[model samples]
Target: MELIRAIQLLKLNAVSTAWVDAVWDCEFTDAEPLDSTVEDEIKEDVKVFKKVYKQLLGFSKEDSTQSVWNVFGENCVSVKSLVAVLACFVLGAKAKSSSVEQRRHSLQAAAVYLLLLRIPGSVANKVFHQILFDSCLDIVLKCWPQSAGKKRKKETLKSSQGDGKSGKRPKPPKKVSEEMVIDEEDDEEEEEEVYFSAQDLLGMREDVCSLIQTLLKLLENFSLRDKPQSADSCVRLFTELTNLEPLVGELSFSEKRDVDKLQSLPELAYHGLWLLCSSSNHGEGNECRRRVFFTDCCTLFLMMRKERAKPCLLPPSQAVCNARDQAILFISQIVDEQTEATLPLLKILIQHICHQIVEKSEYRASGAQAVGRLVTKMPCQNYADFVKWLFNYSLNTRVAFRMFALDVAMVLLAQEEREADATLEPDLASYLSHRFLVRSVVYGRRSDVSPTVRAHAMHCLAQCLELPSHNATKWIHELFSSSSTAGSQTMMETGHSEQTLKRGETAQKTALTFRTIELTKHKSLAVTTRRSTDELPLAAA
Candidate 1:
């Protein structure tokens, strides 16, 4: 069937092979008239092609094409020979498609496997990953939801399409894109790095990290993106992971090759990784998340430089767009005012994006949004200045996702900075932001921050008062002095009481706690330095 379909497709342009050129000159002996078997073979080829091609690519059958179907049987040779020819033809289609569709017709892989008996379908679904087809396949692959393999309470999608027979009839999904060459003629060639720690040649962390890096770096590579093999990197990465003891032992193997591996790796592995990453597919029948999907994603970003792709990590083709945007925003957060070491990662990631996006005025704005998201997860209040820089950058550049950045920053602001003495966690920015909720002060007096963001900060801080007065006052002196500007100034005005404070309470209870900050008519400031019944006064209008 596969051969028949391929042959029919070949007949479309008829002057030669389905590809731009003619099939390699056949060495037929002085034409002892073509046998009738040749006609059957041709019909069979057309039938198979129409079946698998339509299903996998949403491609339509071209009419009146020749095939090589009927030429088979004991007369044609053993099933093994017939199968050999079928495999070769499909592989040819796969290779030709790399240049033609740019995707390996990955979606139709189920059909290829059936042809090879790797699966139970009526026809073979094998396809080589053409970068273009893989590109769109990556998008459709993302749609599978991590749960594709899960047994839902709802009726599960039957694995079998039944009878394994496809026809001239159209499949439900009929969308089509532009086309180009075919894979058969390319017969071609082309083609993961895994470092096993001495700790465990079989340990999954390193392998997992490498796989993640492959996906990330593929997205980061930016240069190979246009060609059909763009996803080749992802495929390669996933393939390497599959070979690792952890995945192979766990997933053991699949009837279908794991396509999520990384286009840069192997087609099937890329698909598996995608299954692992999504909520739906991750938890489906296969349950990729049972091992930890989110951890996989977060760890992918947290990888030590050595663990990631050589030079740097990148995301897969589909992830290229989203990952690039994310990496851009992530880098901007740690770049200037924070840790200078992060500059290297930022530079590398920047190299992987589209040149147009990299240099556009909008990138400045994107930087701001990215920084905002980063600062929320970072370790310092001073980073708000970074947020200011970002906001100003966004203001100047007019980038998209600004609101998202501001939202992330506001979430971070509500968090109190980590202890000055406690050694902080590594690398998510350098310090904790103050948990203050005074919007007017955070946004208005702090003027550098956005008003809406400050308002959110205020809302989060206000929640603290509800903790009960004893608790609220317990930390009053520290809350003011430790991380807040108001706290620091108040400490200076009144020497702290000699009383040794206890833990787990609000600062309001302190002997000389802040009652209210009243802005005097003059621009200079007036602060109330005692805990009292009144709310803090607003800054002078």
Candidate 2:
């Protein structure tokens, strides 16, 4: 009730919400475990402060935070309301108490946590994904309605063969075995009638979406802000973003990538890659700031440019063009306009955009014009490895679609690829293995492409199977095994994936070397004495 009342009070003071937020923040901070003498004394002081703040002066003092905190601090512990609420949720996450009261309080805390996430710029921004998901799982579990078994009707079967000498009826037909089947069906229907309260489930998905939007929005906000607001906040938000990579399905493309429609939404289309692309307080302790910003921007540009699941349903290439201009602008801002030198990561990320359009994007163009665009802007650095990976992943499979005609393949061939030799000194085979493995699983197997491409796809799947789980194979298996259509032209399905089964057999045998287990004959994991670990949590925000 205290939690509910405090939240309500803050919500009701609509006009002065910022001041309220600031005050609540202070109270939250002061509410931390303090001296016994100070704790009791603070309550009285808080009472006096609230009385003076409301009844007299009407908040004449510019410094309202001190008095406001003095009032709320008497009861609360953290200065940041959002963080204070999250701490409670962490309790809920760890505990297993069955008390109804605790359940209700935990649910309320979860609700409050969501509201703060929707209201952007809150300091609790980092854990938005974590809180949202944790709260969602809890809510869903509680929201499942209870049901009861139906009472069976008493029935007797008449004897068909009643020639008994004693005139006793023949044994009843096995307790109405045939008739009992009918009763079971009726029971199932009744059980399914149980329903969760709509008022409780209302806007659940919307609430979830709003939090995701805020997380995506922070990319832009942090990029534009004068400085990284708080290191703790930055760590939390981006860490949440990183953690969200696995829940990609829940955060998938809606197959609504219609160009005009996407153009209308603008920034909304570039939601995924936007965060990692931009920088905050560029000269901070983290040295990768400028490079990360550019690399992420480049990745975002390519993803947006690519086609989504449904045909003609993706953001306009013009949006990519706009972002490109923005990228150029950002580049000029971060690095001196005079410096033509580009980092290797940025160049790779940049060239991939063109790679996606010419070789990978589903949308069609009159010619392979996009290929020309990709190479024209290439830096002096060798990008042959990136080109080869793009060709193998995007062009070699039907899962990848070219935005332009294959007739222009000759021109693309003429364009320079980063040479596989002597560049960066990393094993090309290993990198190729990872790239192909992800491509195979992420896109699923395409039935429309040629056998050669399928063979190449199989090769990549084999590669993932070979690498350590710390490497490509584990992630590839997950991708190929996903039900998301954004991974390919359509949903790859949810149950056992044939792509995984067949390819996995091939991959496993080729890798591990001790045994030759075929990838196609895979089965459910064998149970062992050791408790099996559940799937790792993925970040998707």
RMSD of each: 22.3, 19.0
* Model 2 spans > 4 angstroms off: 1-5, 8-71, 74-86, 90-202, 213-272, 281-343, 346-541
Local accuracy of candidate 2 as per-residue lDDT tens digits, 356-406:
343333333312343444434443333434444333333322222321213
Judge candidate 1 at residue 14 and give its lDDT. Answer: 24
Among all candidates shown, the one with the greatest TM-score: 2
- Candidate 1: segments with Cα more than 4 A from true spot: 1-228, 232-406, 413-430, 433-457, 460-541
The TM-scores, one per candidate, come to 0.29, 0.29
The 10 consecutive residues of candidate 1 with the worst lDDT sum are 523-532
